[model samples]
Target: MFGILVSAFNVALGFVLRTVVVKFILFFGLYFVVQAFVPVLASLLPKSVDIAGLFSSLPDSVWFFVNMFMVTEGIKLMFSALLTRFIIRRIPLIG
Candidate 1:
C-alpha cells in the first residue's frame, strides 16, 4: 500500500514535493519537542499528577520510543533548515 502511494507521488510531483516534505518534517520536530518535554514542564498539571507512575504501568520502552522518534525529528528539522536556506539563497537580487 505504501509503496504504491510513493510510486504515484514520484510520478506526479517530479520531486517538487521536497520543500513541502521538509516543512512537514520541521513541523513534526516541533511536535516531538512538545511531546517529549511535556511531563517535565507539567507545573500546570494537577497536584495529583504522577508522570512516572502514569507511564510506568505501560510498556517499559515508552521513553525509548519517544527518544527514537524525537531523534528522527531532530534530523528532519536539520534537513528542513538546510533546504530553507538553500531556497532563500536563490531569490533574485533587488538592489
Candidate 2:
C-alpha cells in the first residue's frame, strides 16, 4: 500500500510540474513580452480608423459567418502554431 501511494504521488507530482507549473511560467513570460511590444506594434497601425466601430457595425450575416469560422479548429491550430513559433524564437541558442 505504501508503494502504491508513493507511485501515485510521483505521477501526480510529475503532472503538476510538467503541466501546471510550466504553463503558468510560460503564460506570464509570454504575456509580459507581448505587453512590452504592444506600443511598437500599435505604432504601425493607422490612427484614424475606429477599429471597434468597424467591427461593431458588421451585419449579422457577416458576424454569423465569422462566428462559425471561429468555432472551427483552424483558429486554435493557427494560434498554437504562432505561439510555438514565438516560443522557439525566444530561445537564446536556438533562435
TM-score of each: 0.29, 0.47
Q: How does residue 9 of candidate 1 score in lDDT?
A: 87
Across 1-95, the per-residue lDDT of candidate 2 in tens digits comes to 99999999999999999999998898777778767765675587578966458668889999898778774466668867886676567655456
Candidate 1: Cα lDDT at 29: 71
Clashing pairs in 1: none
Please tell me which predicted candidate would have the highest TM-score against the true structure.
2
Candidate 2 has an lDDT of 0.76
Q: What TM-score does structure 2 among the candidates reach?
A: 0.47
Q: Cα RMSDs of all predictions? A: 19.1, 9.4
Kindly list the per-residue Cα lDDT of model 1 for residues 1-95, writing each as its tens digit.
99999999887686557777777777677667656555564565468757557556766477688676785577669967875564445433311
Name the lDDT value of residue 86 in candidate 2.
Answer: 66
Candidate 1 versus truth, CA RMSD in Å, comes to 19.1
Superposed model 1: Cα runs more than 4 Å off: 1-15, 43-95
